[model samples]
Target chain A: MNRTRFLDSSRLTSALFWLSLVGIVTGLYAAFIYAPNEKTMGVVYRIFYFHVPSAWVAFLSFLVVFVGGIMYLRTRERRWDTLALSSAEIGVVFCAIALITGSIWGKPAWGTWWTWEPRLTTTLVLWLIYAAYLMLRRMIEEESQRARVAAVFGIVGFVDVPIVFMSIRWWRTVHPIVFTIDEIRIAPSMLAALLIALVAFTLFYLYLLIQRISLENVGHELEALKQRVA
Target chain B: MDGVKKALWIVWKDVVCELRTKETLSSMFVFALLAIVIFNFAFQLRGDERVGLIAPGVLWVAFTFAGVLGLNRSFIKEKDHGCLEGLMLCPVDRSAIYAGKALGNLAFMLLMEAIALPMFAVFFNLPVLMPSLLLVILLGTVGFAGVGTLFSAISVNTKAREVMLPILFFPVLIPIVIAAVKSTAQIFDGVSFDQSMPWINLMLAFDVIFLVVSFLSFEYVVEG
Candidate 1:
């Protein structure tokens, strides 16, 4: 059983490893080579393929955290808490990636590295919310209590996300519209590239989530072993 | 509902205690005053030209920070005296406890504002005593206090809670702060009430959404 335990985990890890490598290669080819350059923004617009996909998966991670939090509250399941924490940690990473990529895309397209545009501001807030979620988990010492508090926070924080998005959108509309994403009509190739990148990044997010949750489980086991020895 | 009565009882208890000690209110008022003074120096609105331009931002910043100071004390006061356990031991509904605490926090914030607003108006030379501005303050404070109470309860349980509350509080507060600031700015610019209607509605929506969310989720936070 002990020997098989290591083998079992590694088997899934290896499978995900190969799957991600293939998906990433295909995604890059589709985004850069197969997709046509925009008439206006030139090659700089290709960054959207990566930026938007990362943001999509990052948002997806928050949804997972939201659901996991609700489930933990309802059932008091440790697995749910574990999943929430793992996804939130990864969500922060992907959120950072999205923000950085968006900034990189912005420099060439908008002639500025940052703007208080609605989508950008909303994403920044989302990043902050999850970052604080991770901090809340660290500050609490007791296991069950930590899970409980973080779960409550996770659920409550998710509620504000949509409101933040809408309010920012309304704010921009009320004020002068600064930078609009509506102008670029997605050609067939661009649409195909977006789909490919989104699928690839989502699969990658799942791979990372599985690895993170496993690491968390191992940390739990190590702590338990240390307690037993003490 | 008994829950409503129980909740008000909690608020009454807090108010009575605050009235006697005056610790939270005094600190919040002083902190708010200091914040406004700092803003006055920081902005250095050379003359009449820039005073109105940035008065709303300064007012909201001072109020929000001072409100944070009050919120930090709200739950810590309960924890310091070990009153939280006693309250938890009660058979009353948890939502009642949440509503009650939220109301108590809101009252503290409003009281701070009641004093701070006139002072702010005098200091910044803005006409903040108007009815529309008060209404905006009321909606903004409700949303701020609603979410602030829950986070304060959560933060008080952690180390570095004084720091924790703001870290957790500020992000969730973006919409309210933005809406309030925008609405107040428009009102100050002499825009008609109809012109600022959307920002007012934004604040109202945020208040309702957060109030309901906090009310429903407070039980989970306090119990855990």
Candidate 2:
């Protein structure tokens, strides 16, 4: 009975699937048409369409990990642990896109592929910390122990993101804090484009998160089935 | 009254055990001294260039690396003899255990810092023994030991205990380290306390926030 419940997909999940399709199409359309060419760096600024949203979604996924971690530790529920792991795995995917897209954007803008500027360096460190969080989980063998340890780490690791982001502002750094709504003046079209992209990316992220959770639930059901057969 | 007494007993027991063995302290001291020696040899501190610039970085690096050793050992001794489980089995409140361990770790770290500060003055010909700089060290140590105690508990249970502590620790500690280094540098430059107050405030805030979070979350990490 529990196994069947686990395998069953919900209506919310299907809704997210359609939402994600809308998001991807609107996101690309806005990026290519609505957003204006950059005055300083033409053509390449289009990368911001994908790059910024990927990072935003990556950060959102980690926040899920943090909340899920706290819930797991509080309730000692295996489902929360599964949610935390699924979110972390998807978060890594977005983080990878953020890193790669940022690098690709960097090549044209900064005239160099990489510099140990504060923002870039801290983002790299953020990547390493979560990578280590996943590695820590893999190294532990016992299921309960893995969940416990990983939950603790997930909480600790997510708390560091704000610190990493602020390090550039606290310590003097060369990375320009662009796109501050207060600081930079932008045309209406550009703002509209960004808003559309933000909405689309958010939908896409929700879609991915739901899909991953569904797949994880299926895996858990399969394991239970095998256990029953045994 | 009984719970308070029991907590004090735990704290005192840790202190006396350290006094007798002196293992954690001795290794931390020696490790700190060696770190300074390595920095001196590597950087080749010339005449006036030494005093202001090197003092803050050297003290922090020494404290950070030495703190790692001290933090790892903080739990190893408890786990070795199964005392941690015994403590958990006690009726005393769990937060008391965290407070006791944090205080004990703080004392050990301060002792090492106390010794290292004077030695740093002698070795580098810097005036790090100043009262203001000492205040920065005190504030910095509070933040370090607060978070270190928590991460140590979490890391000690992991597979790669030693490596896991730093990887988990250093990122969360960046703010504290930055504040410590900045405040120390300000003091070294003879800046007034007002100039360095913001960094001090940041350190205090971090210490309070993490201290509370760690205290609340510690039970989860230790539960078998």
Which candidate achieves the best lDDT against the true structure? 1
Report the lDDT tens digits of candidate 1 across residue range B84-165: 9899999998888998999999999999999999888777677877899999999999999999999999999898899999
Instruction: Show model 1 residue runs off by greater than 4 Å.
Output: A1-13, B46-49
> Could you tell me which residue pairs clash in candidate 2?
none
Task: Return the lDDT, model 2, position A218.
Answer: 76
The top-ranked prediction according to DockQ is 1
Worst 10 residues of 1 chain B by lDDT: B40-49
Model 1 over residues A73-126: C-alpha lDDT tens digits?
A: 888878888889989999999899999999998898878999888888899999
TM-score of each: 0.95, 0.89
Error of 2 at B184 (Å): 0.9
TM-scores of the candidates, chain A only? 0.93, 0.88
Q: Against the hidden true structure, what lDDT does model 1 obtain?
A: 0.88
Clashes of 2: 0
How well is each residue in B77-167 modelled by candidate 2, as lDDT tens digits? 8888899999999998887888889988999999998888888888777776577878888888998898899888877777788888888
